[model samples]
Target: MQRWKINLSVLWLGCFLVSAGMTMITPFLSLYLQEDLGVEGEHNIALWAGLIFASNFITSFFFQPLWGKLSDRYGRKMMLLRSGFGMSIVMVLMGFAAAPWQLLLLRMLNGVISGYIPAAVSLVSASTPKERMGFALGTVQSGSIAGTILGPLLGGLMADHFGYRPIFYITGGLLFLASTLSWIMVKEKFDKKAAALSAKTSMLGNLKKLMRIPQLPALFSVTFLIQFAMLSPMALIPLFVARLHGTSEDLAFWSGFVSAATGLSNMIAAPLLGKLSDRIGSFRILVICLLGAGIMFVPQAFASSVPELLVYRFLLGCFIGGLTPTVNSLIRRYTPDSSVSQAFGFNSSSLALGNMIGPITGGALSGLIGIEGIFIVSAASLLLTSLWTYRSLRRAGMGAEGRTG
Candidate 1:
């Protein structure tokens, strides 16, 4: 690999580690809250869990754009190091939590200081040539998916043998290692003249500037719909599987299998779709990915057995796998180099908002309409978003053939 690629790969590793560190304990967290923390009450587990996850995103959402701006003003490598350090500390703190509320507080802290993906994204985008950009980012993103795929399995196994604190302790150490990696590697250019723009421009002006790009709405809308649909499959999978006679042994096995299936497919497809976007255009890939996601997720609601559910989940993973790279490609294609980080910061916010709503919506719908029906809502939303995306972009004459910027 080229030196720049190697640098990004290092940063990419950090991104994955951080992602894994945060998500690794998710499977057993509810149990820990209810059993260990003595968090027994009406809505306490649900409320605490919501706050725990939501805290991270709330911090992330407010800080995301700010981090992007800081990165633009300072540098990506430094932010990478900073985020790793912050995340490590928070993860360690999480291991010592005495209550579910403590965990929620720490999760908030995690999000506020953590912006690994955004920072790593800035590094990759700034460093890579336009021709190699898509593949590079797809690869970086795949690391994150890989983390998600491996996290639960590792968490489960480790939790049985080592317990939750040990898992967090190890993840904390890995996060510290990731911080070191960024500090030692990952280099990028600093433009002297352009550094003054963000300070000169107000926040509203900056946001307005980002929004003016004609494709921004299209990209943002698709992001929301996909994220909304995507959360259901993830949040409810364990519960859904349990309802279908899944066992403890089966939990890790199925979680690992399904998570691996999605990650494996994303690992295979992300770079391929990214490379395709370079040749065929982002929206073309976007439409197909979205439509396929809608179709695939529908089957999950209909799944009756573990094997059947995994198969549908695998298919859903395949399609959802391709979506992020497509989003990154679209953002890269339209946004200027000067403002890419800021644009992505806002992009991060959109995802955070989606992240905010997705689980709650999915959880609520599943509870109200029944578990299988959630996929119906997911499918209909995805299809509508896909059709909307295609129509809007086509009417504006946006397609795969026009990109070279």
Candidate 2:
């Protein structure tokens, strides 16, 4: 096999393991706080869970660009190994935490070291041929989506059969295994001396230079809005399911189904759309998918039953699948080869920012506008972004084929 193909295969597995490890503990975190860590009271456990969960993304939002910068000077595979090994150790220690504070601190540390996904993305993007960029990213994204969909299900079963602490050990072990495999199999032809020269400018200097490129800021906004629109309603989804179902019995099952429905379709759609992007154009597909996703959200706001919501969510996923990969491809198209890792790093930070803020904003807005209203706000945001993106690209004279500059 060719070197890029081998790297993609190994990195795909690495991305999957890390994505699964990040999400797996979520389903049982509250229980871990109450049972394993001996936290008392419903409010206290809920508060701790929210804090511990959000803390990771909060730190991640601030730190991703720094890692991205360093990765440009160093090598993407090195950054990938650092994050994989660091997160593996942190996750293992969480199993030994005697108190909630210890676990919270560890989660923050995990976030600070969390660059494996972005680094894998940078490695793949930089190495893959431009013509195949979309498909390669799409394939890698499918691995991530698959991991996300299955992680909670597996975690729940393991928590029931074994125990919470053991699940942590298992997750940590799996991360280490993925890292080890990546180290052995993934190959990067990184010219460290040249990369160091390209990255000689200070981080802020690079940020200003990249932002001055007209296409990047718009692309970055699309990244933030896509994540914001998708995640804002995630936490309140079960409540929405209950409201639509009109009963609490089997509510958890129905809610899980509705949530996974999107991912199931997304896992299927990403690669297909990515392949299509190679033949046509990524920007065109991005606009159409954004419009489609926005329209899907509208019907979801008016969904009268859980089944109706499920259908809308699944359709939305098909379009959401097209968003991220294309954005990465477009970023690569606009970035210099020497600085592509740093560009992707800033994009990752944008994604992290959306992840951190979306739920908080969603929770706050739910009280003022209601859950349905949040859906409407999300729909409106995407639709507006779609229109803005189209006009922005056209005015910049970037044709459907994209400018290689």
Candidate 3:
């Protein structure tokens, strides 16, 4: 096998481990707060869970660009290790948290060290051949997607059997092992002179340079909007499921199935779509996925049963799965090699911003417009984003076939 192929395989596993570790606590977070931390009331548990959940994104949003800049200077491998090991320690600490605030603070610290996925993406982007960028990224993405899909299920099971704290310890250990593997196995051919030269440029200078790239700013917006549209309906999914099923008894099982359905399809579709993008062009795939996902959301809003909603969500996932890998490929195409990590860092921040905003916006709007309205709003937002992306690509001189002008 080729060296890059080996690197990609190892990195794919590392991404899975890190992504799984990051989400393993999610399923039982509120339960942890109540049973372990002595928190009282559903309202209080919800409030604390929201705070804990958002804390990681809030800190990660501010820190991702900084880490990206550092990755460009120090090397992507270093950043990966920093995030992997740092997050492992934090996850372990969470198992020992004595209060809700303690857990929140630890989560914030995890965010400070939470650039592993983007770092891994940047590393692969920098290392892989330009022609194969989409397929490579798409393949790597499936690892993370699979991990995310499985993490909650595993966490819930472990929590039921071994309890929440033990799950945290297991997650932490897995992360540490992942970091060690990356340190030992993954290889990056770093150009120190180039890195030093890139390092001399200020973060503001890097931002300015990145913005000057045609279609990049718009691509970043696409990143934000894609995440926003996807996450907006997440919080209300269980409620929607319950409404459709008309029962509380099987709500958890059905809700979990609905949530995992998209990811399951995404895992299967991302690499295939990615290979197609490699042939046709990443930008073209981006447009198609965005528009297709928007249209998929429409049927979801009107689904008469949980099974119908599940089918719509699965289709949406097939399209949405292509969005990030294609966007990353496009970013790699437009960005200079020396500063690619920094560029990806900014892109990560855009994604984090979307994550932070999407749920809050969805929750707020759901109150006024209702749960079905959330899906409609999400569909409209995605459709508008697709238009924005099209115009931006045109202005950047990328043709309908995805060639740069």
Instruction: Please list the C-alpha lDDT of all candidates, in the order they appear.
Output: 0.73, 0.82, 0.81
For model 2, residues 1-405, the per-residue Cα lDDT tens digits are 878888889888888888888877755676677678997764455456656766789998888768867888889999999999999999899889999899889988999999898789889998899999988987887678778877765675677677789888999999999999989988888998898677256767778989988889888888998888887776566567767889645544566567677878887898899998887889888999999999999998889998989999999999998999899998998899977867987887788888877766776677678778889989998999899989887675556464322
Off by over 4 Å in 2: 1-10, 26-52, 69-78, 93-103, 121-142, 156-166, 180-199, 239-256, 275-281, 302-305, 335-339, 399-405
lDDT per residue as tens, model 3, 58-112:
8998887788678888899999999999998999998899998999899899988
Worst 10 residues of 2 by lDDT: 396-405
Off by over 4 Å in 1: 1-9, 38-51, 124-142, 184-199, 275-281, 334-341, 399-405
Q: TM-scores across all candidates? A: 0.83, 0.77, 0.79
Q: Who wins the TM-score comparison?
A: 1
Clash totals, every prediction: 1, 0, 0
lDDT of 1: 0.73
CA shift at 157, candidate 2, in angstroms?
A: 4.2
Report the C-alpha displacement of residue 110, candidate 1, in angstroms. 0.4
Question: Which residue pairs come into collision in candidate 2?
Answer: none
Worst 10 residues of 3 by lDDT: 41-50
Q: Write one digit per residue (lDDT tens) for candidate 1, span 195-237.
A: 8664556777877887888887677767777777776445555
Which has the better TM-score: candidate 1, or candidate 2? 1
